[model samples]
Target chain A: MDTALSIGSAICLLLGSFLCLTGGIGILRFPDFYTRMHAVSVSETSAAGMILIGLMLQSPDGIVVIKLVMILLMVLFISPASSHALAQSAMRHGLKPWLSTTVPAIKNKHNETASDITSDKGVPPSNL
Target chain B: MIHTLYLSLTLAAFWLLNSGHYSPLILSLGAISIAFVVYLAHKMDVVDHEAQPVHLTLKLPGYYFWLTQQIILANISVVKHIWLGNKTITPTMTTVKSSQKTDMGKVIYANSITLTPGTIAVDLIGDQIIVHSLLSENIEALKAGEMDRRVRQLEH
Candidate 1:
């Protein structure tokens, strides 16, 4: 049981660390702000969750497990809220998301063209 | 009234969990603080169904289990795309219709979208949520509405 638990915890922690590393690479490699947020979200959600769960497995005290769960729950709630707020504010400020030219523009029910925003040239204003 | 009771119970649990000490003095202090906070919450008019959401307490665990699976799958996909580099990424922004009628339901739907690694819910207007995705397939999967249906089920 101890060996199994240790192996599981190690796997989780290693995976979590790898995810966090990818997120850092993604932040640097992604073309624009919006896409980078996706990378950060990956680290915040799964990576954080994995690390917490890994810690929970190693914790002998029930209270420690509960505390870890509380932290996980807090992260699960706060990360999305903050991400949405950031994305919304960026959209409100007219920060156009980068799109690959190969994919055709998708038209929603409102008939608003997302490609139109992507067509705008130059970098988004740094003041934001 | 039930909501208030649930709120107090939740507060008490939170206090006890955080305090960890069972001394009479600490216990009394915790009780007093919990009552004071609950009273303030009541006065603030935030002790209602939306605030407590006791109705969801039973249902949320199942939804969370499902959501955790989705998150893991999405995370793996995003990680692969990251390693493959930007050339393989098909960044797309499109709107998806949320079938939920209530604000809480819609919020859950939107948050689920945002919670997934490859996609983010950029904006929500009524039943429509503008979603940004790292891969076009992520958006396509969301358009299929499995997550939306699950959230709707959770709300009810």
Candidate 2:
């Protein structure tokens, strides 16, 4: 039984590590902020959960289980909220979704800098 | 009324559990630390009606477990896509309305959406949320109303 439990824990750890690896890759390969954020969620929630579960299984003690559960709860509550806040802040600042062809732009915080907010007004470059 | 006690007790328990050995010295130190922190919090006027709703806290575990499952599935999908080098990626932006009534509920709803792989909540336009998805399916999933429903349940 102990051996089986150890094997189970190892398997869980491997799976969790793999998921985390993929999440990192997705964050890099995906085209936009939103997609990257999605990748981060996968890494933060699933991989962490699996690892925690694996640890819990190895321990088999009530207190250990409770601690693991608490950690999981903390992660679940914080990770998503942080991601949402970041995304919302980005959008509020008028970050545009990337376009395949045009590389959609957003108006720079100042007109003088490279404009990120794409507008077709053909406004002349301001010296400011 | 109960939240402060709960938080303090939790803190003390956590301290003891983490400190590894149970002894009178450690126990006294832990008690002092917890009391000091709680007292400071009280003096700062940080504990009051705005405290997180304890009733809603019960569903926290469920939300976490569900979210973990989704994350795993999402990781597998994303990894497969990368390995295949498939150009199957479909990026799109969409909007959805949140069903949550309270400020905390809305925050949770938005956070949950961002937590899922392939979907990110970009903006809050009043009750409506602007989200970007890596695939049309992700957007459809949001439309399916699961996230909104789960967040609503937490509010109760």
Candidate 3:
């Protein structure tokens, strides 16, 4: 039972860590600030949740479980509020969203032509 | 009065769970702190249904479970799109109408949208929520009003 619990907890933690990595890559790769913030919510929700549940599973007793749960509750409640405020403020500040149409050059199939078009246009936002 | 009792018990339990140190001095200190906070809340006249939300205590767990499942599914979809890279990440904004009557209900609905991966509520202007989604499909889902309906159910 102990070994099973340990393995389960370990798997949860590893999955949590992988989710965090995905969120990190997403933040770097996603276009524009709003989408990046969307990526961040992934980190805040699923990644944070996975880690907290793993910890809760490892916690010894009732009080420890309660403490972990309370922390998770706090994160779940606070994260979205903070992220909403962040996106609202960014929108309020007149930042234009990088929508699909804002990026014009991704559909180009020819690699050399895409690179050539990108040269004077000062780099496409990211790769094709 | 009921809110006060519920709040105090919750506070005490939270303190006990958090403190993890149950000596006389620490316990008394924790009690004193809880008393002071509750007193402050009472003085501020904010300990009513909106503040305590004891009614929501039961409704929330069900909503949370559903939201968690959605979060996982959305997370997998988000990870897939991330690996697919930017072209497929068609970021779009849409405004969805919230039929929730109360402020708390609306806030919960908006937060649920923001909490889910691939979507974030950018602004809550009156009854309309301005949402930015990573995919066009997510926008359509938001337009479908499933989450909005769930939150309204919680409100009832």
Candidate number of the best lDDT: 1
- Give candidate 3 misplaced runs (Cα > 4 Å): A102-128
Candidate 3 local lDDT, B23-51, one digit each (tens): 99999999999999999999999999988
Q: Which prediction has the highest TM-score against the true structure?
A: 1
Error of 2 at A6 (Å): 1.5
Q: Write the per-residue lDDT of candidate 1 for residues B76-120, one digit (tens) a residue.
A: 999998889878888888889999989999998999999989999
Query: Among all windows of ten consecutive residues in candidate 1 chain B, which has the lowest summed lDDT?
Result: B86-95
TM-score of chain B of each: 0.97, 0.84, 0.95
- TM-score of chain A, all candidates: 0.85, 0.73, 0.77
Name the runs in model 1 displaced over 4 angstroms: A108-128
How far does residue B99 in candidate 1 sit from its true spot (Å)? 1.0
Better of 1 and 3 by TM-score: 1
**Pairs of residues at least 3 apart in sequence or in different chains that clash in candidate 1:** none
Number of clashing pairs, model 2?
Answer: 7
- Candidate 1 residue-wise lDDT, A39-122, digit = tens: 999899988988998999899889999999999999999999999999999988877887776667564456344446655533
Task: Give lDDT per model, in order.
Answer: 0.87, 0.71, 0.82
Tell me the native contact fraction for each prediction: 0.81, 0.45, 0.76
- The C-alpha TM-scores of every prediction are 0.93, 0.78, 0.87
lDDT of 2 by residue, A15-102 (tens): 9898888777877776566556766777887789889988987995777887888898789778867887887777667655553321
Docking class of 2: acceptable
